[model samples]
Target: MKRLVALLFALALAGATQAQDGPAAEAEAAARMLEEATRALDDASAARDRVKALTQTVRAYEAGLQAMREGLRRAAVRQQALERDLAAREEEIAQLLGVLQSMSHTPAPVTMLHPTGPVGAARSGMILADVTPGLNARVVKLRAKLDDLVVLRALQDSAANRLEDGLRGAQAARAALSQAIADRTDLPRRFTEDPVKTALLIASTESLDGFASGLSQIAADPTGAPGPAAELAKGSLPLPVQGRLLRGAGEADAAGIKRPGILVAAPPRALVTAPAAATLRYRGPLLDYGDVAILEPRSGLLIVLAGMETTFGETGEVLPAGSPVGLMGGLEPDDDGIVPARLQDPGSDWTQTLYIEVRQDNTPVDPAQWFRTDKDD
Candidate 1:
């Protein structure tokens, strides 16, 4: 009995050692697979919630990317290594897509046929008929693979978009560091002797009304260089992030709330850049809306960008056109902030919303009138 007990302990120790030796990347992939399994829905059930499930998948992937990014940052690592990792994954998906594409072009019979003569053809036909069940299985598997290609393509596009955001973020960080160095001695201050006061004033305000009122007390930065006049560049600025415009300015949502803004269906954690050179007015929460940012490109013209998950940059920070402001947060399965904010459409599959409101002379103006609206009609 003692010998048997010792043998059992030895076997358990070996099993533990094997588990310890498992590759971390493989472990991470397994965890992702398990998570997907938990979140999986039946084909019929998924058909009912197709768009919802896809959006959830997108958000889940984005959250995973965000988490990995945070870990890399904490470790003081660059994204090039992570990009390589993603590239390998992308290549595998691409190869699978390639196979599906080839198979789609070729009929099932052609795929089963041999390159030889009638003898080869006879042998192939007999095998095909005998293994009809497997052929049917293959057809079903091919169809599933085709569907996966679509989802994989969508995921790849999102990954590419997020990668671009990451690159832009790195550039912005470097620029911020340079500006910080310059501010110490070179850059002239317009608001206060110490800019920390301005940061506090900007961050402490709870609502937009209070922020606007406080801005009035703090004079404009004269020493700060004037950027391209946003009032003149009304119709030419590029969209802040890559996304399909879901809602147009003045378009009332299902709730019958009409807001003078455009809503974009962007990927989760999509970075928001300045459409034009502007001074950040507010970069904190306001009311029930999520994290928000108000930018003043010129007097009387305020560009408010809201519904961001995480905000960057201080309130008084001046950014050039296309500088990073913040990131779009994932609109989770439980999230309803974007829906009530009218940034989301009742019939849309948006993973996240990039809310844009252009105000002129303190009056909300249609963003369609200002920017080239590429909204889906």
Candidate 2:
């Protein structure tokens, strides 16, 4: 009987020992598996064909790791509960052994031991069965689950880091491509030839009021010419203004339209003199005409002063040739208060300008043909 009891105790001790070691073994195995998965991900990142596949694998690994982490938490909880239960059971067993020892010490008559019948034997057998095996099995299972969770967490972290790096690389590549394209393509310049004529016309109409009056007279003309009817009939018109021709008369395009005029660059605020002695036909600002002046100088020519802001003579006022009409003002500054006012060129010192237009009848004619350097002739 003593030998049988000792054997049963030995079996329970062995079972307990197995249960304690199972979790550690399982944890080690899971760690090895996680390391293998990490290596596979690194290999995928290096391979071109397998890069996409690697990304997917990394995501999967990450998910698995998260699930493993949760599992580890649960396993830890279970392990704690199991440990508490085992401790309580151990305490109870210790108390029972103490009671048994105390009972043994009590003075009692020793009775003759007799073997029970089959039913009694079976009941005794059931009572002696060890529960250590079941406890060991549960502990081993929990340990294995915890190990798997640890492995999964490691994999997930690695995958997340790789994904971040990949995204940054992709963004950088795209930016480089865009910059390359921009470098290859040449952008258009802001200033173009289309605005040349428009600028010239604007320069022609520097004075607003004079331009207006000139257009009104042309509109009221019976011969439909830009000058007085009497002057037009005689095949002569008034000189617009008196200024040295800086640019010769020619055809130029402005704002996508052809304009015929002579660019007569003059001194800033210089007095505009009439080309001939004639009546003041118009003296006001016109559309595209700044301060302008039109005079019927003789039967053959019409002079136009396009930059005059103020005029001395009214319509029908008689004036002799080379008379002072208006003063020239500089171009107004832009809204930003920045003015690009400078001399036309290094050779020409004149910054302010007045445009002079000469016309035959209603059509513009070359001023070079009729304009003389001196009025002495």
Best by lDDT: 1
Off by over 4 Å in 2: 1-244, 253-258, 299-301, 331-348, 373-377
Ten consecutive residues with minimal summed lDDT in candidate 2?
Answer: 332-341
lDDT of 2 by residue, 1-377 (tens): 33333333343333222222333344344444444445555565355434233333333343333233333333344455666765667776566445544544554322122167667666655654564355345435544444444433443344344434433332332233233323322322112223344345445664433343234333223333233234222323233332354555564536553335556554333335555565565666656556767666544455676766555444544554444455555431111111112211222323455666666555677665665533311
**Winner by TM-score:** 1
Instruction: Write model 1 residue lDDT over 83-124, tens digit each, in one string.
Output: 455466677646644554555567656665678977898897
Compute the lDDT of residue 339 as modeled in candidate 1: 17
Candidate 1 residue-wise lDDT at 86 = 47
Estimate TM-scores for all models. 0.44, 0.32
Whole-model alpha-carbon lDDT for candidate 2:
0.44
Q: Give the TM-score (vs. native) of candidate 2.
A: 0.32
Model 1 lDDT on a 0 to 1 scale:
0.53
